[model samples]
Target: MSDVNATSVRAIATKDFRDAVRSWTFWGLSLLFFLLVGLAAFAIGYFGNADTSTADFLGTVSQVTRLVVPLIALLLGWKSIAGERESGSIKVLLSLPHSRIDVVLGKYLGRATVLSLSLLIGFVIGAVVVAVMLSPPAIADYAGFIAMTILYGIAYLGIAIALSSITKSTTIAGAAMFGVFVLFYVVWNLLNFALQILMNQGYFSGVEVTQTMNGNEMQYERLPDWGLFVQTIDPGVAYANALSVIDAVEAPGFGTAFSAELFPSGVPFYLQNWFSFLILLVWIVVPTAIAIARFDRVDL
Candidate 1:
């Protein structure tokens, strides 16, 4: 394989980005995000009391995006390389002066840019609506929320693009996309539940801690720090925790009494919300790195 050429990467990225922007996929995502945010703002304004703040609005939107962004990314990226290969269009792509590394990097950037732009367009529209509906909008919190959401989307895009490059068939790529979805959305959540059950069954030891609630002392078993760390390793969980750290929103159920009991001294650096930012970064980097390495050696 040839060494990475910045000029080649840039040219490929530009071409891919232009092509993606022209597609309905880009506009559909933009519309989807806009509707999701607009509805969230409307619900907050219509149903919430005057005390409902912009942080609350952002929190709600973040939850929605956590589920929606990965799906958008997967759909957008599932066929990036696999579709090209299946249709034999990859020959034209490689006929250019680009290397495989350039193609992989370019594809990842192009698809990620599509998702990012759609997010921006939607958030801008949503911001305007939110500003009018919610007084004293937490612009800082909203900005932080948007930033973290983009990172989260990029992480999934990276995953999707990597998977796309590994296979020659779009059908297999589509299945891989579904597997990615299930791995994160369903299986990851189940792991935490299963761990708790094991601990309850005495299969895994848990830390016992006591706390006073409304002047009544209560004792409960909390997951060990390692277990808590495992729970936060999910990209979606990391995204929420990162938001709490950046926006100071005190994400619901995070760092609560139960959490404090799990870490009496203090949350370890790895398990802290700030560390989740690192976890998100790792998610964005690792999968793509592996894909790039493997794609370079594969028979195209």
Candidate 2:
């Protein structure tokens, strides 16, 4: 087994990026993002009153992005290493003095760059159009939202790539991607609901907090801090919660809103809005780390 070589990693990354850039998937994603932002702008400018700003536009678009970005990242990564291995191109790739670790790192860098560039193109154009349409707020916040969105997208991409690296079967990799989609969007939500049911049934404990909504005090049994941590396990939830931390969003939302109301006695460290970023970072790291370790030890 060869050690990771910087030059080899760079070569592989550049080649991978060049190859991907020429594909329809790359252009299609870029066009999709451009259209996503354009549509978001149209929605706000057409139906909204004076209160609408770029932040509102971002929040609206982010809702769609949460669903779209992960799917796109998964699709883009579905064939990354698995297809190459299936076709025996992994042999040819390794013959070029690139270590397996380099291959994983390089592929990740290449694809991550592709997604980031595609997002930048769309957001740049959208920002220009947004300036013409809405009462634009500070560009700093909008940039922060774009940055966070990019990080969110990268986290999903890393997960997909990690899955891609583990198996030689593209079919299995594709199935894994779908499974991931189901786990996060469906099962993750179900887990939260199930916890709520348990809390209501007194099977699980939660802090009863009184929140003033509609100027009326309403008592609610909120999830315990640990249960709340479980909800933030989803990348989308982390993205939204982190968005609130940077003031990129107006509301702290993702099923549960983070407010003093939810934690009258002060919020726990793990449930803090800023902690969501750490959660996202962990997702990005842990998956790839698993892939590299497992992939390296496995027979090609």
Candidate 3:
């Protein structure tokens, strides 16, 4: 691979970003996010009782975005490189003063920027509506949610872009994207159940813990720390955990009997909320790094 030239990378990124903005996909994402936030705001105003706060509203929105943003990112990036190769456009890009590594980096940054901007626009519009309807929202919490949401989208975008790079056929890339969606949303959730099965069959040992409820002692077998760590590594789970830290909003099970018993001596470093941020960073970095290495060696 040719030496990476910062100038070439920037030039390609700028061109790609501008080209993407001109496409309908960019505007569509903005509108979708806007509508999503608008609906959240409407629900909060019409249905929420006196117990609700700005954190509650943002948390509810985060839950929706956690599922939707990945789909948008996958659709946006599924064809970024593979489509170009199939259409003979990749040659034109390569013929310029750019290396394969440069193309990969530039495409990732450009698409990441597009996704981030679309998210920001939607969040801003939603914030405006939310501020007017709700008592002045918590600016810091809202900002953190937006920032985290962008990071979440970028992680998925990296996965999508990497999958796009390894294939010459859009069909394969499309399938890869679908596979990723299922891997995270479906398979990740089943991991805990699978772990339980293993424990039940004596493959993995469960930790014995005791709990007292209503002056009655109960004994139960919980998954080991390593097992719980594995569950939290999922990007969506990490995102939710990270939000609980930043937003100061107790998530559904925060300080609950189950959670307290799960970490009797305090949460492990790997299972803590801060670690989720690192997990997210890894999701963004590792996939792109692998793709860069592979794409550089491939006969594109």
Candidate 4:
């Protein structure tokens, strides 16, 4: 790109970033994330007890991020583009000589930077709590979690931008973005439930057997194993991958596995997690591409 174009793009991005940061919403959200991190750490460390291992402490931290960070990202990003359009500034901004690609990418980067800072602060607070309670976390673990959070934040930003690009009102865009989160977060569980119910209905069972025991004697039992596949298809499985990365410090205890373990197989090596990660990437890239395309053709 020419220096002039580069300068224009940067100028646009800088103005957006400044406007975003200056808004009360940004600081409020950042403070909320900060408080959440501190509270999550306190809850985990206090309830987890002083004897909780570093691994467990960090695992709790990861859980907090997985469940909480996305909401913060959504709040930060849901209106990035749509808000501009609502205020009638989008046309003026797009009138610049820079391509829509530059505008879209630069806006994404600027908002993402703000989100990264908030997430970083929250994570650091959690880490401090972990260190005070147990051994410090490994640098590798911190690096991996940070990378994952960034990728996830980027994914949310893409979704928000797409929603904004298509809608003319910020209120509508915000609603749509929240709708997306609700669909992803809740619909996945409902799908899993339906799959599990179907599997348990015995449609796949080719044979049925009952086990009876006399004294210490036991008899063999047989049933269809197709239920496992249904479990794998559940979108909640992605959350399991996030958990695995967070829990990488050590495998959960057998006791932990016997009851309510997240990802019993631990990040499913046979392409399930890999597939979900790819889907998430697509979710990020496709909307972003569309937003860029629309911006290019838009009258603004």
Q: Residues 1-300, candidate 1, lDDT per residue (tens digit)?
A: 568988888888888889878889888889999999899998888888978888788778877888899999899889999999999998888898989999999888888888899998999888878877787467777777788889999999999989999999999999999999999889998999999999999997998888777889899897878888888888888887887787735346433223565567976889877888899899999999988998898887
| lDDT string, candidate 3, 167-235, tens digits | 999999999999999999888878878998899888979988887778898998888889988888888
Give the Cα lDDT of each candidate.
Answer: 0.85, 0.87, 0.85, 0.62
Model 1: CA > 4 A from native: 248-258
- Each model's RMSD to truth, in Å? 1.8, 1.9, 1.9, 5.9
**Pairing residues by index, what is the TM-score of model 3?**
0.94
Give the residue spans of candidate 4 off by over 4 A.
Answer: 1-8, 197-236, 242-276, 298-300
Number of colliding residue pairs in model 1:
0
Q: Once superposed on the true structure, which residue ranges of model 2 sit more than 4 Å away at CA?
A: 135-137, 251-256
lDDT of each residue in 239-260, candidate 4, tens digit only = 4455454445343420112111
lDDT of 2 by residue, 33-108 (tens): 9899888888888898888877788778888888899998898788889999999999999887788999998999
Using all chains and alpha carbons, the TM-scores for the candidates as numbered come to: 0.94, 0.94, 0.94, 0.74
**Lowest summed lDDT window (length 10), candidate 4:** 253-262
